[model samples]
Each structure stands twice: as C-alpha cells, then as structure tokens.
Target: MTGVNFQFTRGKRNKANRTRSPATERVLTQLKMISQRRKQPKLLQVCQEDHIRHETITTAFKLYRQEINANRAKLLLKQYESIKYAMEDLEQINSYLFHEANTNQKGKRFDLEMRIPTEYPPNQIWLHDYTPAEVAEKK
Candidate 1:
C-alpha cells in the first residue's frame, strides 16, 4: 500500500498514410486548382464554392496577407521617393526664380533671356550615405 500507483501506456500512433475525409480532400483539390489556374479567388467565393468555413480558408492562406502588405509597402515607398524628388525639384526652381527676380530688381533682365536650370545639383542626389565619416572628419 504505497501513496498512489498509476500505470501509463503509450497508444499506437496514427500512420502517416492515414486517409483524409472526402470533404477535406475535395477542399484541398479545389484550393490547388485555384492556385494552378492563377485565379485570385475572393474569400466569399472560396467559402461558397468549397463549402468550407471562412476560418479554414483564412488559415490556409495565412501568408498571403503578409505578402500583399509587403508589396503595398514597397509601392508606397517608391511613390514617396518620386514625390520627394519632385518637391526638391520644385524648391530648386522656386529659389532660382527668386534669384532671377532679385537680379531683375537690380536692373538686369536675365529671367526672360536665361533658361532656368532643371538638372539637380550633382552633390544632392545620393543612394547611400552621402556624407561619410571620413569626409566629415576632414571638414
């Protein structure tokens, strides 16, 4: 008569080759067909056609939201950069016009004779760190 004695036994595990239910098999087949056809099926359409729960459909394509968001973010970043470049160009033009107006006030009619410069300054455009530590140290 000890405290408490319990016997534990491990049950046989299910085999990997276990068959899926017909409904599950059909849903999987429909998903594969949709993917192969390159058709972007709407959630409601998939739910109606596959006769599966919306939760199941969402879980199966869980990574899709991340991919879509990533693409949207990339496109937004590109648009932002283009707009920034355009703004910089406009600012440069405004400064040029201001300078021309000042010169005209001083009796020089250069704005009508001289074409405004549209090209950006060479030192302004950059894809990486424009001012390196070495250059800053030299300055």
Candidate 2:
C-alpha cells in the first residue's frame, strides 16, 4: 500500500539429482553387474522400479540437452536473420557500400579481442578514473 515490495516466495521446483555427464553414466553402466552373492535375490517389483527410474533419468537428461541445443540454434538463427536484413537494407540504401560489405574475404578470421554481449549489464559502465600514458611518442 505504501511502497513497492520485492519479495521472493520459495516454491518447489522439479530438479534432477544427477551429478555426472551422460557419457560417464553410460560408461559406468557397462561396468555394473547384478548382485551375484544371493542369500536372497532382489524382488522383481524392485528391479522393475529401478529400471523405470533409470529410464526416467536418461529421458530427462536427453530432453534437457535437446532444449539447450534448440536454444543455441534459435540464437544463431536470430543473428543470421538480423545480418540478412541489415545487408538488404544497406543494398536498398546505397549499392556501393553494400557491395563493399558484400566483398568476399576468404582469409577473414574472427577478432580475438571481441567480447560477446551478456544478458545483464556489466558492474562497471565506463572507466571514469582512467588516464592515458604520458610518454611522448617518437616520430
């Protein structure tokens, strides 16, 4: 009623319990064997339940990996589209600049110094207390 409230309410979230990579899991699966020392063997129902749980975990990981891949593909597609549109707009605006941009460079490589943009703004906006080198340059 008075001011804005910023409160976070805890809620139950479905999270996986796996701590290992799927490849590692698969490799470990090959090394496992059913218990041989049988005073009493495990029940059929228990075995089935364990199998189901394994399948569920495998399915969940596969789904999660697929989701991640799809997101990456979507981001790449968006960037491609933006470039395509910008190029088209440039062509319409001026042919010379567009052709200059469209020139093929077979040996072009990505700049090592370029930084990828992040989802959130950085902690420091600009270097306000920065100073340039006072050393004089020889002609």
Candidate 3:
C-alpha cells in the first residue's frame, strides 16, 4: 500500500497554502481593540471624536477586517518561507555543480556540469565520482 500524506485539518481549510504575515499581528490587535470598544461605549465615542468612520467602528467590519488580516499574514509568511527555501535549494545546486578543480600543471582549467534528479536510482547515478553524502558534506 502507498503511504498516506493526508493531514486532518478541522478549523481552517487550505491551511497548508497559507503563511503568516507581519500585518496579521496588527490586524489582530485592531480586532482586540474593536471588541474592547464594543464592551465600552465611551471608547467607541472616543474613536468617533478621532474621526474614525462609523462603518469601521462596527462589529461586522471588525470581523471582516480580522479575517482579511489573518489571510494576508498567512500568505506573507508562506511567501517568505518559500523564498527562503528557494535560496537554500539554489545554494545546494550551486555547491554541488561548481567546485575548484585540482590540477598538476602550473596553470590548468576544467569544466563541470550537473543535472538534478536526472533519473530514479539504482539506474541513475551522478556524473561525478563523489557520492551524494560526500557532496552534501563538502557544502
């Protein structure tokens, strides 16, 4: 039987596609403030004095804003992590593909080429003599 990579997500759908963003914190803070203001009409009055719109001062608006912020934060965090991993992969490929060649002459040069995951093992093998473990350790 094949291995199951299924994840049981109860609260949030498509959570794996999401990332946390810096703005999420700010949105959550605003939602907190909105809930607090709802409990105290005096604070809401103060917001009105500050020229905050009535639509923004509502509980419904607060809920929508909170949801939007959460999604934004998730996307941002995901993007950041993806970029980070991509850079790491690039570094890995570079280290494996390019290296200083050893030469006996006063001046000598050599070329190196690499292809990633060319074929499945045991039929597929890396072009060079170095083992995968050795190449990884070198980097």
Candidate 4:
C-alpha cells in the first residue's frame, strides 16, 4: 500500500512572498531604539548582558537569513534545471514549438500565486481546473 500524503487545507492563501527582505532589520531597529533608551532611566531592568545577548541575537538572525537564502537559491536552481530539461525535451520533440516558447517567455515574472506547500497542499491547487462561469452555465 502506498503512503497517503493527504491533509485538509483551505486554499485562500495570500501572496506575502518576501523578496530579499530581512526580518532582522525591523527587530534590530527596535533593539537599537531600546539601546538608545538605555541611556535614560528605565522602569524595568530585564536586559542583563545586553551587549552579549544583542551579539548572539544578531548572529543567530544573520545565520537564519543565510540558511533561508541558501534554501531559496537551491529551490530556484532546481526549478531552473527542471525548466531547462523540459525545454530540451520539447526541442527534441518539436524545435519550432521550443523556439516559440523560448522566444515568447522573455519578460514573464514568476507568479507568486504558485506557492510551495509548507503544510498540506492547497484545496484548490490549480485555478484553471475549476470555473465558476462553467458551473453557472451548467445550472
């Protein structure tokens, strides 16, 4: 028996794809503000070993960002290689079609709607399959 990769999901996902954006900047800015305020009197003295903790946090954030960058790069590279291989196969089958595809796909931006599934796959994986107009017409 094959293992089931099934899970329930609601497909109304947002296009919140981050492109070269660092979460660390916002956090560091707040940290900087806190540090600046340290000069004045404070209500609570919770920040013990402030410099060391700051360094650790900064380092961890940088490392995490690098890891995310590397993973993204790897996924992109895999996608690129797959596309290249597909083009090669298409060229082998039909050169004209391959040329048309290669030439026409010049200024196409990557669609953010096609997201990598983190948990379970989206309920409506492909938008092209279901048409409300068709359903209306049928009824």
Candidate 5:
C-alpha cells in the first residue's frame, strides 16, 4: 500500500488496569490525607519535594534584594532634597547680606550681615497654596 493509504490496526490490550506499585499508592494516599487536613501547604513541606527548594530560595532572595535597593533609593532622594533646600536658603542669605556695602572715609568697607533669626516663632513660615475652605468642604 502507498504511505498515504496505509491504515494502522489495534492489537488486543491487557485486560487489567495497570495498577500503581504499592509504595507509589501509599505515598499518594498520604498526600491526599495531608492535603485534606491542611488548608495551606507550608513552604517547608513544598521544599521537601524534589527540585523546588532552589527555585523558591532564589526567588525569595531576589525579592529581598529588590526591596533593599528600593528603600536605599528613597533615602538618597530625601537626602538630596534636604541638601538642595539648605543650599537655596544659604544662597538667599548671601544675596541679601553681601550685595551692597558702605565705604567709610578711610575706605574701609563693611558689608552688612543680615541675620536670619534661628528661632522659628509661631506662624513664621508662610502658609500659601492651601485649598480654599469652601472647596475643601465640597470635597
């Protein structure tokens, strides 16, 4: 017969269902019992299964490293912003103090040092850009 026209025929099969070996059946029965009793499988229980422990450990390590790097990035950004604000304040003070000076008859010049009070008395900081009371009430 040509390859295209060839047909396969079935032979007589074994009458018995190929039974699982006794040890395999016992293990399967134990697994079923454990699964029935426990709602959640413990990580240690799953790790005992072959080849899964390495994958789980590696994934956990990577997640922890990512969290550490993210926290470090946030801390560095906060430090940068703090330094930037301090520099801005220093620039403002320098401009106010040294931009103009007065010369006396002996040509001795004195640049006035404008003192920004170190103490923040109550309500010293400007409070602008707050949402209007009426708008806040509507929200």
Candidate 6:
C-alpha cells in the first residue's frame, strides 16, 4: 500500500491577498499603541520647554527696555538701544533653538559671555555663548 501526500499553497496565497485579516489588524494595532506611547511624551516635553524659553525671552526684553529708558547719556542710549535690538534678535534665535531641541535636533545655545557692544559707529552688537535657557533667565 502506498500513502499519498497532500500539500496546499493556494490557501496561503489567498490569505495574503485578503484585506482586513487578523494578522494585519494586530500589526496595525501594535504600531499605533507604540507610537502613541512614545511620540506624545516627547512632544509634550518640547511644548513645555518652548513655553519656558518664551517667558524668559519676554523678561529679558522688559529689562532691556527699562535699561534703555534709564540711561541719560546720548552715546549710552545708543549703545543701550543696540544691545536691546541684539538681545531681541537673540530672543528669536532662542525660540528657534528651543524648537530644534524639542525636535531632537542640535542647535547653538544662546551665548551671554560675549560683551554686547556699547559704542560703535554703526551700532552693531555681537552675541555669543548664550543658550535658550540662559537667555530666558537673563534680566
């Protein structure tokens, strides 16, 4: 007596062609769960950091305005204004940095170490070594 062997490949191909199958559903569900658990926390962190940086920059601007108003010397006023404008620019840069950091991207932090020029013929100032965190806390 000889035994007959039977194998089926057609069913496998048919299953592959079918949509809304159990395997596909399971895979999609797993992917969605993973994404929700991971990406959301990061986004939240970014948002918080952005808010903190914004508040800091705002404070810096207020202080700069006060300083500008207090000075009576003509040359000092001009220098104060230049520093103020440069600091405003620095604030914008910090916003960009915070955004970049939240996105897990690298960016230059604000530099407070550099002297903001007080007297120049063109009224220009250079900002260096400042980070968004530092710029925000600056008075």
Give candidate 1 misplaced runs (Cα > 4 Å).
1-57, 96-139
Task: Give Cα distance to truth, residue 139, candidate 4, Å.
Answer: 38
lDDT of 4 by residue, 1-139 (tens): 4775544555653345322236855687688888784367656555669867988999999999999999999999999999999999999999999888868655465555657768887787667854454365688
Worst 10 residues of 3 by lDDT: 96-105
Provide backbone clash counts, one per model: 0, 0, 4, 0, 0, 7
Q: Give the per-residue lDDT digits (tens) of candidate 3, residues 1-139.
A: 4764554556653536434455875698788888874454454444554555555568678898999999999999999999778767766778543332212445232333333444565443456564454465578
Q: How close is candidate 3 to the true structure, as a TM-score?
A: 0.28
lDDT of 1: 0.66
**Please, what are the lDDT tens digits per residue for candidate 5 over residues 1-139?**
4544433546643335324567877899899898885469566544455557778889999999999999999999999999778767766778553333222345333322333556665453544655655566699
- Higher-ranked by lDDT: 4 or 6: 4
Model 5, global lDDT: 0.65
Model 3 has a clash total of: 4
The TM-scores of all predictions, comma-separated, are: 0.28, 0.43, 0.28, 0.42, 0.33, 0.20
Q: RMSD, each candidate, Å?
A: 21.6, 22.7, 25.3, 24.7, 24.8, 22.2
**Top-scoring candidate (TM-score):** 2
Worst 10 residues of 4 by lDDT: 12-21
Off by over 4 Å in 2: 1-46, 108-139
lDDT of each: 0.66, 0.75, 0.61, 0.74, 0.65, 0.67
In model 2, which residue pairs have backbone atoms overlapping below 3 Å? none
Put down candidate 6 lDDT per residue, 35-88, tens digits, no spaces. 874445444445878999989999999999888777656778799999778767
Model 4 clash number: 0
